[model samples]
Target: MIEKIGFPLVLFAMLAIVLVETNIMTSGIIITIGLNLALALVLTQILALLYGFSKSLKILNKTRRHPLYSPAREASVNAQLRSLKK
Candidate 1:
């Protein structure tokens, strides 16, 4: 949820900053600083989301590389081994 909204939030914040600078919207120093801070926060959230995705991908690749990690193949192999033992 946060990841999806982060980008739009950043864009909106940037637009607000532009509006403030252009005097199209009446605002004060505090509002400008607040908008800048909000922009930084949204950007940080985006970075965190990217880092989390990378970590998940790494974990998925590691699991895929394991010899017995495939569910269908492991089930068939298990059945064959049981039949041989019997």
Candidate 2:
């Protein structure tokens, strides 16, 4: 599902709104907490994607050292390596 709203932001907004409606917190407090929670939630997703991409790049770099990395370098190259199967 496409999340139009992040869970954290929704949760915070709900709680803040409820508190204000109940006279537990003021509207000013809701504005403060809601904005910060939204920012933090978005940053979390951004950082997760950044780290995941880094890990993928590292795996590709490591695999490039393997002989099978490029199976069809050239016709002669494959002939030189010989078939792994007997």
Candidate 3:
């Protein structure tokens, strides 16, 4: 997914830079846009991690028959158990 998303992001950034060079954008606007996008990506990643952690915690508190019981969730719970054991 990162590979899929990264190509399009790079393409868009390059396109924006090209537009700026063509006088279609004002000075500092391109850089500001790029910085904002970068910050958004960073925050998105943080938010995803937080969501994953919350989901994992929820799974830990539920029984096996819970609809949200996924293999990945189980794996995360097991990893947490092992870490706690150490």
State the lDDT of candidate 2 residue by residue for 1-86, as single tens digits.
32755575578866765776677776686667875666666798899999999999998788777777774665666676676443
lDDT of 2 at 8: 56
TM-score: which is higher, 1 or 3? 1
Ranked by TM-score, top first:
2, 1, 3
Model 3 earns a TM-score of: 0.47
Per-candidate TM-score against the hidden true structure = 0.49, 0.49, 0.47
The superposed Cα distance between candidate 1 and the true structure at residue 63, in angstroms, equals 0.7
Error of 1 at 85 (Å): 36
Candidate 3 per-residue lDDT, tens place, 1-86, comes to 98998988866667766766687774677666864676677798899999999999887677666786788987998899999999
Residue 84 lDDT in candidate 3: 100
Candidate 3 residue runs with Cα over 4 Å from true position? 1-6, 10-27, 64-86
Give per-residue lDDT, candidate 2, residue 15: 76
The root-mean-square deviation over C-alpha atoms between each candidate and the true structure, in angstroms, is 10.1, 10.5, 8.4
For candidate 1, write residues 1-86 as lDDT tens digits. Answer: 98998788767777777777788875877567658867788788899999999999999799879986887986798899999999
Which should have the higher lDDT, number 1 or number 3? Answer: 1
Error of 3 at 83 (Å): 19
